[model samples]
Target chain A: MSESRIERGIGLLLSLIQYVTASGSVTVQEAAAHFGVPEQRIREAVERVFMAGVPDGAGDFIRFDIDFDAFEQQDVISVTMRPAFEDETVRLSPREASALIAGLTLVAGYTEAAPERVAALRDKLRSAASQGADTVAVDTLAVPLAAQRIRDAIRDRSVLAIDYRKPGAGTQRRRIAPVALNLNEGQVFVEAADLDKQGMRTFRLDRIEAIEPTHDAWPYALPERERTVTGSAQVVATRAAAAMLRDYATSEPVSVDGERVRLDIEVWSEPAVLRAVAACGGDAEIVAPASLRRAMHRFAVDALGGPSGEREQTPRD
Target chain B: MNRVEAEERQFSLLLALVDTSVGFTKHELFVRVAGYQGQPVGDALERMFERDKDALREHGIVIDVVQPPGDDSNQEARYRVLDGVLGSPAELQFDAEERDLLDLALRVWHEGGLTEESQRAALKLRADPEFRGGLPLERTPGRTSDPDGAEPATASILQPRQRPRESAFQALKRAADRRREVVFDYLKPGERTPRSRTVQPWAAVLFRGRWMLVGHDLGAEDTRTFLMQRIVSPVKDRAAKQPFEAPGDAATTALAKLEEIWATASVGVHALPGSDADIRLRHRRDTSEEDGLLVVHHADRHLIADELTGFGSDVAVAWPAEQRELVRQRLERIRDAHAEATGEAAS
Candidate 1:
């Protein structure tokens, strides 16, 4: 797990103050007594000692000083970290990280586990990420597909024309009024009332060739207040494209100020509104109205450095 | 690992071993426990094997049946923990013998002394039942080192290198706990060894699996890592010394350079290593990783770099600029080293 700045700071303080080379430096019982913690807790606290040090001032190693020749003795840590094993690291521990990665690779070369724990593992990964622990890229055939769009449509009771392919059908075809999408294995299965079947059927999205609005809309409209938001991927894609262009902006959504999506994100581009617009990936309009867009166009022209210079043609959809 | 004692402590040890393994197979149970029985004991072993599961289950340990392979006909009966029971925690129930092991671990972590089978015996606790509230090790056991009843003879332990006397280790520990910078009247090991040198203590460590005292040698005006075993004599300094502080963990930032810890860097940029993504981080020696991380370090750089190449997308770069550069350079060198190492440009 990644450490928080405070946790690391505390560790730094402890390392500086309490990392004694005393023979009884860290006894679980003693630590528990001194810290007023349980055995489980103290062990957890003590395990941090394993990751307690930034090795060699470069912050490369999560090192613990041990008194054994790793090459000679096969301690648990040493065995797992035996110069040959490699695993994807979640945080900074090379042995565990490499061991895990190596293990997954070894496992991947063989079998697939039942589909479960995606969210839990992802949550663990997210927690580790929060603590600044980088997760090893684990390749699994069991991760659930992103079903945000389907979820939103379902939540809103909006009509969806899904291009779906049935297993062994050998091809994809269109359908109407999808209720939701559920993930089974790595692919998404759309749950919709099929007109032909007049019943609920699951269609794999990957098997689908396309998606479009049918000539018909929803049987009943969703109230505006009940609509859900889903655009992280889209926003991220936009930011990545901006970064590719060497100009970028990042924003945190502010109050949904009326119909406008007010954002208090940091901006660096001169045409601030355009950069903001670009960051939003067209989901955002210049709700501040003429002033925001006009200033952006002017800045775009200014960036081009002349009124007729024609650099204003920024590729925005 | 003995026969007579194994029979005497068989029930307790077996129960304990069950707690340790979380679960054990019948074959494994036979090999470990019956292997301890020794000599023409196969008949008795067969009896124990049949009754072993029932006996262990009586002691709140269950041998779980693992899932059979889809294609296999003969089901491999695997053992595991019973539901709602994670067995024991180590600190909870270490007996005197196990406590002795903990004591040894404590001493070495403290005094920097190594002894015969201490690491081995202590390692055994890993195979013991997780004890409940064994003993608090935070406070000193009152400056009194317990006498191990079954101490192995020194002759049994080959001297791999130099070993500091027990007295010296105890002294260093006492001084360090008091937060006093110790003046080592250190006698260096090997030919033409010097008798003594004064130094300001920063931290004492077990490194490369040997005790080392890190201190600023005032005369030399430099920090040095001194192996404890190499010191023939070490005395607390006469001069008033400042409190010794271990170097911030940043010292181990070099751990990423170790071969075994390289898989954490196995990421390829486009999120193509299946579903999980990888990122590179440089955790300095002081950067602590809590969530079940494994780290390794070696004096060899190339070995680590070479090992890092296989992680592919599962690993990330998380460290020293030079190490990252070395990884980058090593990837470049892969072109020249192995023919099959076709260039795979990863972002």
Candidate 2:
């Protein structure tokens, strides 16, 4: 087998080994069938398993007797390898960690992956701080904290009392029946009764401040007209938000600071308290809303001008 | 390269990157190439871009320099490069089927949220070489039917293509290149603990989308499965005291086990008393079976408890065990603090 192919085969063997034990054995013949490899190739791969003890003192024998025939028939073989009673290995290479880190790193920014080349430059030297870091910060993306309570109170197929904050508008707190928790625009939205109107309206998670789940459960249809405004855009206040703002420090208006942009945003996030954080872009970008997030979408936007220069708006005439 | 040739070649690369189907604006194309050139700002270079575009077109290279939505007001029209016509006269356009698919996909994506990654992917698709046929439906039924030779493997700063096995090959290469016997931890399935093992590295490979390393464990005197992702703090570039040898186990391969790490990392948080049971959350909705239980997905029970504790006396953890006891204590403490302000806890 090619060196790379052998590596792949061995990796598969290790993954299978995770399921095997001193008392249990994964058969080679069955693995061959599953892998669509010859029995000998399967044996070569299985023999790569981490086990102790040797038959005839060679250590090359199936540390324990494995029933090859039974394995081929049943697709599982009994293991006889004696436990070595040693520690296991779990260290991944920088490259593998890089991939996983790239995937999960979005949990914080919640923004999707950036361009690959840019990601590589950013990923270089910036490994995930070990789980043993001095401090670990936390936050959420899909839902806000204040509304969390109200959302729970709604219960499934139940009536809800939402203390909602409107878009650059006032607060409306009322009890309403809820139909569903769905997402529109990658944002989680709730379809429930707009208590005053007695009609169903979709509330963004960010806009919900307080939720009271009543004991009553009922089913209702989502009003088709209100579907357009499905979910709310929420901003979270977190240490992660702060760290990201620091990263945003790079995109601060190039005109203002060599490395910074004038950060100001007007977002529709709610719960008054949660909106006050350092999220990026237009999500509660006030410098004072310490709890609010500062969001920046302008850089990524394909507009024609820098932070300065009035957008050449077409003459209304 | 002459102005015409340079522009033509640059557009060629750009077209290869983003298939003809997904067109790019002049600004997008310029920024992408500027990134390649380290932001060269000069009128001469800009002029070259125009000249080369025309030359490429004359050679039957259909490079459409398009000006996207945001008008720069240069009033000078711009175009984007697509397929190399090599002197053909037909302007390459999306056929009905390709147009339909693109429209539906774009609608779903736009409605979902203007996801930046999706947009980038779409933009890149426009210049990709794989977009040979007029539209995907014309030849094949499957969506995104780019012929094998035309597929564009995009790698950008924000979006890197870490295909399966790439990591494994890299790790194994590093190990072999350095000749090191490394030690690391492996989290197995149905188990709570991650154990450490010493390994003599032989090779690594990417099977699907993850890395797998095949190495001989010193403790086991045999080979084992090592999931590339599950490995932590790998100390690379060390020498192996012993030589390499093939293992003789008659069971699963090491590579498969490495791939199983995620599904196998059976981890449960050490539940503090408050996090032990289902907690009833009060939303402004009616109660249902699904909404009744509050699942604290956190691996840190205390952290979950702390969050629950924030609700003060309003929430309670139900059943499983008297899980609310911890929260109750917290509430009592808060209540006492308030009472001290008003002398209630003492009462």
Candidate 3:
């Protein structure tokens, strides 16, 4: 076909062969799925390998011995006789190496283990790929002391008492069975079973002013299904706010009709929903759920110190 | 040539180039490689050979062009793949624990643009006999074996928005890695026009949900952080007449500088006690209540306003007249929109 297609085909074949050689035996279906290609393409590539060899070779020609019976009956590709270079490891392309290096560097930043071990591993990967170590950099979010302590409690499976600052509620002592730690965007969240609330709750790590491991052991097993601290909200807004909505919304807008765009958003809390709506200024309104609408009206009236007509503007110098 | 023939030729060419220690000259390669065989020695063969070399290089195979030790002429350049460059080192091996750790580390890229590379690396590691028997790697969080309808709860669930053009990021990353300067037209957050800048890129960092290029702006004579999203023009590599070493903690320093900017710019808001607005704003780091007003530190006033607007009547911008006016305007608009929608519904 076209030149670049042929080039890509060869690259895919080379990578597939490398993978098969390393893994010993991989099914044709597995190969197809892993490389995100059609099964027929993988089969054709394998068939081509039988005809490919050194030009002047007598008995040492390169060949892949496929199990014909298994292939015909069960769609299994068992390479009976591996290629001569099967022992040779597949070399990474410079772009591939660079991408991996960048990824590893980012991982190193987030890792909580010994700094030296991560540093050594990063150096090894760089040297092996013939790439410089400092090519890619990442600055991980600084984990607070309280967050670190909470992490320790998670690993130890202990009950933790934290001086958590819940929005509007002020600081309060919370005892929770620390389950897991999650990082979303740049913020860290701790998923735990609030012993007092007796339900799953997510605490933003930064909001935890103080945390201590209670000597008591974990009282319950982690739930089979991890509860996500996110909910979807729909809103209609002006073009400017809609533009901002596109930025903050987790996904694309559900629908857009002129300046009013309907967006389905996943936010951490009900307050987060209110915060997002407020961020839009007054250009946006939550159109669905009559209950939420009433709440918004109340929230607005309260902030204004009365109804819209009589509300006084508390201007500050 | 057909697909099989083209690949066979390339494969034969690789075998020839890699087999020889001294490397093969142009004439020797044409005679030895299978694809070049049977073809008449002419421009056609030369063109095909050139294309093959490019294809191989694109796959990260480095073919070294070397002159025979005794010969001192530019002509008759010989080529060979360098030793160990394409092959794994014999001494390099990983135990079960290290392999597991690597498998875990590679998982971080599940939502990133580097999935293909990470997958290839994982396959490469799995190929080794020692690592073959290790525990099966855990699937990405959302794809786990948990019962259906169990919402995948990842702490860091928000993936960075995919950039419109990744080439800018790739170019900036390369320049930073090579210690080279780059020139590009940048649009500041609120500015209407773009400005050209020349800087020695120190580090490319992901901060506050965006990729930022931090570097020494030669014109401003100060370190500046440029948002990748706001880079209006393609990043062009500058001539490397002089290169400066990146500080050992370049990334950390750049992030600290961003934090400093946020710390210096503060805003004040009055939220009714026990309201969602008051609770959420108070929970934010570096925010405190002073005389019934919530004092918030932020990098972008517009961003803070966006947050405050979501609270409706529960919160009011207490200071920074510009931000207060912004919130006021937004609230009025929302109020007007709501009244219109309700009026239509009632009718």
lDDT digits (tens) for residues B1-347 of candidate 2: 21322422343333333332455444444444422233354775567566655443322234555554676674444554443221111111234433323322322222111122222222222222222211112222233323232321111001112222122334444454345667665543212245677887654433323245666678998766455544533445456677653342211244344335423322121122222111222221122333334333322233234444443222334432323444344334333322222221111
Local accuracy of candidate 3 as per-residue lDDT tens digits, B1-347: 42327666776777777667788788777776666866788888889888887666645566788986778774588888866556663322565445544644555554443444455554445445344311122322223334233332222221221232233676776576456899988756434356889988876666555567778899898888777756656789976667687765666677777788777887777766565555556666678777667888887776566567776766667688898876666666555555433422221
Give me the displacement of residue B239 in model 1, in angstroms: 5.7
Which runs in model 2 stand beyond 4 Å of their true positions?
A1-187, A190-201, A204-239, A243-317, B5-7, B12-117, B120-293, B298-347
Tens digit of per-residue lDDT, candidate 3, span A194-286: 877777787877667667768765664554435564656567754345445554576554446532456656555566566567665565677
TM-score of each: 0.20, 0.26, 0.62
Instruction: Provide DockQ values for all models, in the order shown.
Output: 0.02, 0.02, 0.24
lDDT by residue (A1-317, candidate 2, tens digit) is 11223223223343233334422555655444333345675555444342212222221222423555655576565554433212221122222222233333322132222445334433431231111111100111233454344334343335666666553345677677653444322244666666557567766664565666665434344334443322232222122122223322323222232212233323333322222321121211233232221122211121112112332222111
Of 1 and 2, which scores higher on lDDT? 2
List the global CA lDDT of all models: 0.34, 0.35, 0.60
Candidate 1 Cα lDDT to native: 0.34
